[model samples]
Target chain A: MNRFIARNGPAYAFLLPWFLGFFLLALGPILASLYLSFTRYDMVAEPRWVGFDNYVYMFTRDRRFWKALNVTFTYVALAVPARLIMALVVAMLLDKGLRTIGVYRAIFYLPSLLGSSIAIAILWRQLFAADGVVNRVLADFGIPSHAWITDPNTSIYTLVLLAMWQFGSPMLIFLAGLRSIPRDLYEAAEIDGTPKWRQFLRITLPLLAPVIFFNLVLQTIEAFKTFSSAFIISNGSGAPADSLLFYTVYLFNEAFKFFRMGYASALAWVLLIIIAVFTGIAFLTSKYWVHYENERD
Target chain B: MVEMTRRKLLGTAAAGVAASALVGVPALAATRIRHYWWGNPERDKRTFAVIDLFQKANPGIEVSGETIGWGDYWTKMATQTAGRNMADLVQMDYRYLFEYVRRGALKPLDEYIGKSLMIQDFDKGPIDGGRVDGKLYALNIGANSQVMVYNTRVFQEAGVDADLINWTWDDFAKACEKISAKSGGKVKGADDLALMIEVFESWVRQNGREFYDANGKVAATVDDVATFWQFWADLRKKDVVRSKDKTVILDVPIAESGIAVGDTAMSQFWSNQLVGIQAVSKDKIGAAMVPHKAGGKPGQYIKPSMFMSLSRDVKDPASAIAYMNAWVNDPAITKVLGLERGIPVSQKIRDQLAPGLSEVEKLSINYFTAIQNKVGGLPLPAPKGAGEVRDAFMRTGSDVVLARTSVKDAAASFIDDAQAIIDRAQ
Candidate 1:
């Protein structure tokens, strides 16, 4: 132990700052929020412990809590798969040695690069507004315009479209994963007279499992936590009847808008648990599908 | 994205250096006060001008101002208060005053009244409005009556003479329909009524009841709320006002609002917003009182535009009070502020500035002043959970217009929701 410490002391010294930051900056607030979820706080005043009141109220009383959960889950269900499929499709296209593929990748990557920003959210709002360019373009094609973001029935779909539009980062990851797949495997399959579709299903699908899993978990979490675009499109009030009321937006309104800090803390904890559960489900389910090259299982 | 992170890191490093540099300066050598407020650009310009005047008048006192948009201001204020980094002075709203005072976030100004505030000729009506629990916690900046601001062009185009001063709900409906028909569907009459809290409050008042009681309960009956929704829904059906979808589309900014764009004839607005709304167009916009039910009490009553109060953690209450005095009572500030904050609450300032007032300012002042004797008593002070109630009101309004629920059911559910929220807060 002494000899190992002596050898790794310099490495440990270099990592000390990050370790300290992880404990102090990241973990501290997380634990504090957990404690706060059990309390009644208005931010301006002292937090009071109310045992399980916040949890009980959330489960049995708060209608908005249920609505937010429903909206968030629906969004994750629709957006994650749609975005991942689009990413995989585009990555496959770019995997072939097409000229200007780099430029095309960069251009495709631009939307996700700018996706989470408030400016892009504002631009998205403008494009999807009732009289916006989307409607104007539709009119040119003799298709009547629909209130895309304004109508309650269609607002969440616009956000799903936005989520799908930002498939760039995952696409890039998929492209990298695709490149790492050995060419011999596909060539051998083709030599056996396997059809291209069958080879893709058997070879590409199995080889890309780790990358696909990563993209799925990352995007599902992101879709659950989406705030700015929905918040902006809904004018920060979650209106045209709360259709754009994403979970994070609802939590924000509860904490900041209504000063229900304790309730918001509980909402945050619930969101953390929900994401953990979904991620857990993904991992438990992945063993049957995801194949690692050296895994004995 | 790569550029954003690099710039952010640089910004943090620069801020660290600047903060460390600031550590050397003594903070209390001179009385330094930080004031925070939410306002539009015009009001910001006017307030800054007044601050400059005050600074010139008192060189020993150093004052800095910070501002945010109205929507985000309260969130920032609550976060600051929680962090104990509250500004020495804050501009407050009537809806939020009770909540802040109840939470001990505001400083009581009763002790400083005679010493710091020179209110010799100040009107009691405006002063009394700022008191909470019979103790002065804030000072009124200005008071404005609710008004119906109309674009003259739209009204003319519709060939509708909306005499808003003596108009009733029925009259408003007929005029809207006329305007919609006359314009050949190029414009709707109004989509404004459904979302306005004050408008609903005033409707209940005209029916001889306040929308919210002194306890901040939902004072209006289901019938009262139902009637309000039914009125707008009927108007929607007749195409007198915009449909729910159209309403949401025009909900961007006043610049793009139906009235400002000459798509609607009129909207209910506070008198102080007259200039900002009129600034978007050269259409000779006009102002008149809000309509009420026939043979009912007047729907127009003055509301304090905002209040200026001392923070509970003020470093120098005396300096803060002195600055507040200069802001409210000094005649010179009247020239700089004009009617940007609504009519000046100080009688001396109002009389002093009346002669030099611009046409727009004069119109806001004259409209409210003319309706002085007609307006009902002041609406009850908003209670602790007022913000949530207001939101519920808005949500309920949307629910009604979208036919997600019937008007009566929405009203009943809103009452239940508001009561539960208020009770839970208690």
Candidate 2:
């Protein structure tokens, strides 16, 4: 036992720094945030316990909270499905082995790399502006194009499109998943005279379910925490009648802009609970669809 | 085995020595004073020059200056102040002056005013506006007042005089209609709906009702705000002015304004923005006092463009005050800064620098000087919910324009939202 301990001592010591960082930097802030959820910390003064007040205000009173939730859900509902389908389709096309596969992959992945940055958000703002490139093209086509970002009705959809255009990460994941699916299965299906659509449904989709689940969870989490794009694009007001006021944006305003740190912390906890519930449901529902090749039924 | 043991000992000793040296070094080697301000490129260059001048003059003081876009300045300041890591000296806006002061973030400057700096010649109003509840928390750097800046060529093409001193709202609308017709819709009259509350507050004050009560509560009714909206709404209906897509340049600066870029004939902006407005327009740009209501008192006020305040938690209050004194009161520093800080509040500095002003600066000075007789009381310290109120104003105004709500409903909703925000803060 002593020998075992001695042999592993240096290995454990090597891991100590990372463990300390994880606990102090990551875990510590989360725990602090949990405590702050029950307080009325305005960032200027020390936190004062306000028990359920922030939660109560969020659920029952804060109209902006509801508005933000609606905007976020609308974005996710549209963006997630659209992004997934587009990614899968593009991945399938790329998998067909085009001549300039590397160039195509790079082009497809470029938006994902750039989309989340402030510069791209600024570019997005300019592209949708009244006299901007998009509008000028529309004008060339003899179609009257008003300010897309300035109009309330169409602004959120523009954000959804921006989110959709950055489907490269999910596409790459889907592409890898598709490649991992055995070519023998498709060959066998073809011998049995199975249709291409049926092969895709029976083999490709069922096998790709796990990858889809992974992508969905990750993208949903990222979508919920979205701030920079909305912040920079809307110029921080979520303008045109708060059309782009997402959950994180509202939380930011509460915490920083209004100095309601406790309220924001509560908001953070609620978001965690929401994500937990959603992820739990996704796992629970996966049983009906996801297939494991090695597991016994 | 002996050789391995000696090597291990040497490595351990070397690591120990490195660790000790690293720990022995101070985290902050110098007494660093963080200074934050917002301005244009010209202002930024001038401010940096002043900082260089300060660093040269006072070798002991290490000052770091961060400049951000004006739109983001307050948001960043609010976050930093709330985080309790605010810069030593903050360039403060009048709209947010009371909010920060009431939160106990700003140090009272009364003690340091005469001892650390001299400002006896400056107007009492501008200086006193920086004080809340008799505690001087800020020092006015410069003053700005609202003015109507119009393009001379656009007005000439429309056959309308650009001087708008005696103009009423009706006259303004007529000019806009005429300009639009004459310019073949290339030049509209004004920017998006002039903020309703700003105009409404002024209107209410002119009609003998203060926008805010003595206790700093909103005094105007929903009907008052609705009437203000109706005037602009009518202008929109007549096609004299543009709506959301055409007029309102959301979340951008006055320099990037469509009106200032010659897409429109006139705009309501701060007098100090004349330089920026002129930079965009090839045509001659001129300024006049904002038109008052017919037979009503002028509701214009001399407002502080921005103030410099010391943090309450600052380790060296006297030094911070000294830095502010040098930035604001020093003749050489003021010359370098020019009217980029807005028109200098220090009468001595203003007199010294007035003669050698640029055309834009001269226009700004003349605009302020002409309205010197008609200027109303100084703007009050904004209340706690001022940020929320400003947001509500923008949101509710958009709602009204979209026809999602009546002007009356929008006004009432704004007041309710604003009141709720204040109540929550309290």
Candidate 3:
């Protein structure tokens, strides 16, 4: 033991802060919440062990929970693909040889940095308002407009648009992926009398599959965890007929507003399991499509 | 040489830590208490000034003030309560006072009432308004009631009577239709009042029913809710009231409400919010009673705007109670606060501050003053799960107005969910 401690003491010392943080802050709360998922706790009173009552009620009776799941799933389904496509399109444009490409990249990246802020959420709300700038611009063409943010049917789409607007991070990663592809492959395809569209399909897409898979997984997880924008635009009560009630917003309301901490804990575990299932599916299917250059035949 | 320097660095850090600990021990002897409140900038300024004065008077007692917006206040309070580190003096809402007290998160102030907490001059009604289970757990900070605030200019432009004191629901509806017609569809007549639970409570009372009975169960029925929702739905269909979109826009601060922005002629607001509404409006603002039920009971009652309660685990009860006493009874503090929080609960403080009040302030004071004696009995304290019930009720009401659900179906589901929540909480 003494020899082992002497050999690795400095490395252990360097890692102590992170180890302490994990055990005390992250791990403790996670385990506590797992235990709390089986209870009835209103925060002020003692938690009573009800043994899956919260989960039973959530699955069988809580209509709002189902609504939240539906909203979140719809948001994820739309936002993930929309954001990835926008990122790839912008990234492909930036891949062209231009002297001011760096400046354009910086400008495109500004949105992701400011996207999740409360101010941006408020601005997005105004932009989609009934008489807001979008409507004014649309009215110039003599097209009738509707209240975008307040209309239940169209409100989630506004959030999806906001997600699309913040395609900066993935765009950067895609730009890196685009640059790493060899120029000679495209040149050789062109010399062999391949059209631009066919060249893209045969060469560019197969090589970029790994990057696309990476972005898809990352963006899908981030979309499921969306809270602040939904919370702010919905006015914190999932307003306008609960159409904007994302999963995290609903969990936050249940935990804090309604003081249903136990139920919220149960909801949180269910969400974790859902995200895990999605990620596991992505990994298990990756071998069929996402090929690595260094892999053995 | 490098090894010697590293050892010296470690010794210096140890010495610095030891010196700070020695300094902190002396500072710990002085009693420090935290006060938490939810308010806007104006209330924060006044509350901080009062805390400053209290700290100056009692040199050994250091009082720290914390304030948050109303939206996040209860969430923070619940987190603090769960951590067993609630502020010594907690600013509480009436709907939450019962929950906090019943959960044993708040200390009963009855034992200290005659001693450190001096509120003998306060009115008995306000005092009793703070009680739960016959125990005084909080002290009323101010008294106010619900009212309909209207723009006088809109009434004149529409050539409609502005006196809403005796207007029945039918008369009010006719007036609203006339106002909308007069505006040529530019200005809505009133906000969608069905969105507010407080306004619905008054309607329930006007119909000679209690919202919640003595047993803390829902006393208002599905028919009552359906009738109220259908009335607003019919008004919405006629475009006499703010549309669902407009209502969503105005569901913000009182200063940004429909009446304040000239988009609507009138809206339902707390009696105290008239001053805030008047401040933002270019038109002449006026306060009047919410329309009555023709021959039914007077629904309006004096409500404690908020309460100052002591945490059950307050480290220094005497100091905290003394601050509460000064906040309620001190003439100088009352002048600084004015009618911003609500009308002062103490008659002496109200009379003392009456002479220097602004015209807009007097509008709220007069509105509450005239109705103080004639209003009905106070309703029972809201039950433990009332917060959830209120939000669910508002969502259901919005569903009705947005035409997403029929009034009867919305009311039925709301009643079912509210009863389930209340039952599960018990």
| Superior by TM-score: candidate 1 or candidate 2 | 1
Off by over 4 Å in 1: A1-18, B1-29, B249-252
Instruction: For candidate 1, give the lDDT of residue A193.
Output: 96
**Which rank order by TM-score, best down to worst?**
3, 1, 2
Global CA lDDT computed for model 3: 0.88
What's model 1's overall lDDT? 0.85
Fnat values, one per model, are 0.72, 0.60, 0.78
The iRMS of the candidates, in order, is 2.2, 2.2, 1.8
Question: Model 3, B1-426: lDDT tens per residue?
Answer: 999999999999999999999988887638989999999887898899998888888888989999999999999999999999999999988988878887899988888877888887788988889888798988888878888888898898898874566678888898889999999988888988887888888889999999888888898899989999988888998999986886754258877678887788888888766667777899888887878887988888888988899997799898888888888877888888898888887888988998898999888877776776557888888888887888888788877777888899999988888889899878
Q: Write down the TM-score of every candidate.
A: 0.94, 0.92, 0.95
Candidate 1: tens digits of C-alpha lDDT, residues A127-213: 988788999999999999988887889989988998999999999999999999999998999899999999999999999999999
Residue range with the least summed lDDT across 10 consecutive positions in model 3 chain A: A286-295
Instruction: Rank all candidate structures by their DockQ, best first, as comma-separated numbers.
Output: 3, 1, 2
Whole-model Cα lDDT of every candidate shown, in order: 0.85, 0.81, 0.88
lDDT of 2 at A240: 76
Give candidate 2 regions above 4 Å deviation. Answer: A1-21, A97-103, B1-32, B246-249
After superposition on all C-alphas, the RMSD of every candidate to the true structure, in Å, is: 4.3, 3.7, 2.9
TM-score of 3: 0.95
